[model samples]
Target: MKKRTDQFYLVREDMLSEAMLKTIKAKMLLENGKFNKINEVVKEVDLSRSAFYKYKDGIFPFHTMVKEKIITLSIHLEDRSGALSKLLSLIAQTGANVLTINQTIPLQGRATITLSIETAAMTADVTVLLGKIEELDAVVKVELIGSGA
Candidate 1:
């Protein structure tokens, strides 16, 4: 047996500077397909291209790893024929396994769907999967909410 001890650290979200926030926003825009090119992402986020280059590798979201393995995704999708079907098809094509799925009633013109998936056999990297999901016409927004393997 080994002794155990509790450890903790405090972080203040408000203490983050504007540049850090802009860097994170730029990365999110790229992740969400709101901006395709790096220049466009940096420009839209009002950060210089040099700043983007400088901070991008180190400015990933706190939940980025949640997008990499077993993942919980929240999707806002148009309530239309074959929308969910097509989304699932893409996931299958990527060799990801669906662990669970839940959807809310269509409100207005869209529905909120939560899917938990395992990526043990994912055909490519998570970034590729994210790009594919973002390309789906019926998908309005896709967020990585949580993950557990």
Candidate 2:
């Protein structure tokens, strides 16, 4: 049996057809609380109600595109002077906001650091980011403990 899968595409706003753009605008109007009724919003945007209904649930504003995602990582680092600082700098460069950090005291020249990071604005895939961090000199191990989106 063939599996049914949902697919998404990122198209530039200007590339969309006029009717599609109008549909998006109509949705925005209702979402912003500027208009109470669907007919008023559809009329203002010059789109038909049938078209609005066709795309309403399928479209959303670009700014609201990324859903909330969080990743929790467990990293083992060499107990060096600047290991933590270097790790944090790399995360910042990728736009992954560090939400919380907990580090255990070094035992036998190694420490376990737990980091919870928000990935909504991350520039690279989470796995790529983790792999990059893992390649650093002071990093002994990197394990993904949990994630939510």
Best model number under lDDT: 2
**TM-score for each predicted model, relative to the true structure:** 0.57, 0.55
Worst 10 residues of 2 by lDDT: 59-68
Residue pairs clashing, model 2: none
Q: Give candidate 2 regions above 4 Å deviation.
A: 1-68
lDDT of 2: 0.86
Instruction: Please provide, for model 1 over 1-149, each residue's C-alpha lDDT reduced to its tens digit, 9 standing for 90 to 100.
Output: 96744543233657777887899899888888898899888888799988788767765554354455688889999999999999999999999999899999999999999999998788777668778999999999998777776
**TM-score of structure candidate 2:** 0.55
lDDT by residue (25-129, candidate 2, tens digit) is 887788889999999999998899999888777766543554348888999999999999999999999999999999999999999999999998888777678
Number of clashing pairs, model 1?
0
- Would you give me the overall lDDT of model 1? 0.83
Q: What's the residue-level lDDT of 104 in candidate 1?
A: 98
